[model samples]
Target chain A: MTSELAAGVSGARMIELGRGECLALLAGVPLGRVGFTRQALPVIRPVNHLVDGDTVVIRTHPGSALARHTTVDEVVVYEADDLDARTRTGWSVMVTGRASLVTAPWEAARYRALLIPWTDRDVDEIVSIQADLVTGYRLLR
Target chain B: MTSELAAGVSGARMIELGRGECLALLAGVPLGRVGFTRQALPVIRPVNHLVDGDTVVIRTHPGSALARHTTVDEVVVYEADDLDARTRTGWSVMVTGRASLVTAPWEAARYRALLIPWTDRDVDEIVSIQADLVTGYRLLR
Candidate 1:
């Protein structure tokens, strides 16, 4: 628990999560929001993801707009947040990194086994982001 | 319903919703993701918002990181998506606009009445993004 003195010293009491906490939130969470660009306009979608080391993995249909827009070495932002409305307490974590399609058959197979899509649509395209920065924040009631 | 022949045409199979349908999804939705920046570093977060005309309304506590980063007249991106895992059918909408604080006393009061925060934290600052562009896509199972 954070003390009143510490809160006073900081002026505001927002909780800050470090690298380990941020990693835990990213790894344990199933749903996240991905932000990318199509024709220089921003697009965001919610997706289920899997975290492996410093990389985040997601799958999409081969002919989808996301597949068309995202390219190797393109910058993308991925975020996940958990909030408890009752307590008004929550945490949000974001990962910004370079995105690339995982084309290697063995790597794709490994991700395919671990990252299961609830949709029946065949997700032939797999994208992964090599995170350059990971940060998170928590709010305490 | 879209016909199979229509689906065969490139870009003809895309599902498009008008202003009302898009606004309904934006207002009724509980969770959304916002893509913004601080010094060109992309930051994305899950937020709860309301629809105000052609703009998206969001409230954040004063002195918060998000509040600090977002200023009036700054361009930002807001996105909302609703997905059904079972049917593999969903819609996503993106809004690129300029951000401005809602500061008029009467206007703020009206917004305060219409917009309620999902979190109990104090939200003294309210910002609205007047969308310059709005686009959405629907997935057909």
Candidate 2:
């Protein structure tokens, strides 16, 4: 469990990724899934994201259950990966942190300008998650 | 909240998916993300899965945290999506259900042969999540 390397049955080895590399990979991806608790059960929503400094930011509408139910300092998980199914090789990064609504007008405005929502909806709420714990793995042959 | 039409800013309309359609889409995907609680916080993992009947099954090694920590009847969320970044059109399906380890020798063997593990690791544990509540959305431009 403590080892960083785990070889799979398909002749691929899993290498643990560093924080710096994880953040870099996250910034390059256009989409990610954010997981939060709803009714004490997990709920995942795939949304476009932008890496702002050390935080992961996403725009959601007021009508979205994700934005409406997320309380301040709520723990959430954001994951993004770039993998090839054919080769079974790629990297996946998961960031677990506290989620809070970006209520500041200027901050929200900046995020809105940089992070465009993939769905056709108004950007009514901007949620920023502090990347407190980052873990990732890369499968290599 | 109940009507099921939410359009994104990119002129894409979000249409809710039905149970039958969600299952069909899930069967077609080779990969998905499973979200479960770890230490009272959400954890998301990308794993290759197979839709067996109405359940999503994935194999894991014993050392993996997901398999080790997941308890019987643990509420989990499994999600799979196929989206085009350029066109901003795609479909996402989510299934929330209880996760149980496949302890039956025969059942485990069947899943082992059918569901290929993405990583190069031994298949020591098999997890099956019942598709209790299936929900999805299709983004159409």
Candidate 3:
């Protein structure tokens, strides 16, 4: 069964997403993947996140794989994409920045209020990735 | 609007996926994210891929970000997940391995016949990420 979502055309062009538009799209999505390294091997984890100003905030367990792999000042990537499963047309926004754990009380509280993990676990650590560089693209066809 | 897909329960236990199961799941999915590093920053790109034995073969443009970031023996992460949008219950599989440009004539031809890029672009590079270590998890609720 097809829904009202936009369908992919036979011959569509690629559209470059502006920085502002990329941020807007990223801020709107709830699920995103975090890219990082563990023991020098690249790793990706799907985490529920929220865009807080210029920072991408995600709730993770203090001992989660993400937390263990990410450290202060470590460069990480946060990407979110919205694609029509049927049409396979979508837009992807990627943010490259440094990741740091939220240690301050007020800031941690703020993140805690805004972001919630989709999985059940003790989520007290708030990892924030600075959205220093944003790049995006739209696939239409 | 509820579908018959698994709905996440409120207090479901986390299930660990074995290596064989993880590889099987990865082989079944047509799309996955490739994680790599560019200038020391972690990056993730979504691509259509197929599992050819222990190798994950994908097609991408020669000048694509993924192609530029990946080199011979470069460590990369390939991940795939199928989570319900409404229920948010799904399984995720991640493979950590080195990305290599397929140079063998026979392997390239084999990959070309089996894999196709989802985007409209000149896909001249056939990349194979060696599935060295596979890890997966299932969220049930």
Per-model root-mean-square deviation over C-alphas: 7.4, 5.1, 6.1
Highest-DockQ candidate: 2
Per-residue lDDT tens digits of candidate 2, residues B12-36?
7889999999999999989999998
Kindly give the stretch of ten consecutive residues in candidate 2 chain B with the minimal lDDT sum. B1-10
Per-candidate fnat, comma-separated: 0.21, 0.66, 0.44
**Using Cα atoms with residue i matched to residue i, what is each candidate's TM-score against the true structure?**
0.74, 0.91, 0.86
What C-alpha lDDT, on a 0 to 100 scale, does residue B129 get in candidate 1? 78
Q: What DockQ does each listed candidate score?
A: 0.20, 0.46, 0.29
Q: What order do you get sorting by DockQ, best first?
A: 2, 3, 1
Per-model chain B TM-scores are 0.79, 0.88, 0.86
Instruction: Kindly list the interface RMSD, in angstroms, of each predicted candidate in the order they appear.
Output: 8.8, 6.7, 7.7
TM-score of candidate 2 versus the correct structure, residues matched by position: 0.91
Between candidates 1 and 3, which one is better according to lDDT? 3
**Model 1, DockQ value?**
0.20
Candidate 1 C-alpha lDDT tens digits along B39-141 = 5556687666888788898877787656765664766788887665445467878778777778787886666655555444577578787778787767664
When candidate 3 is compared with the true two-chain complex, its DockQ is 0.29
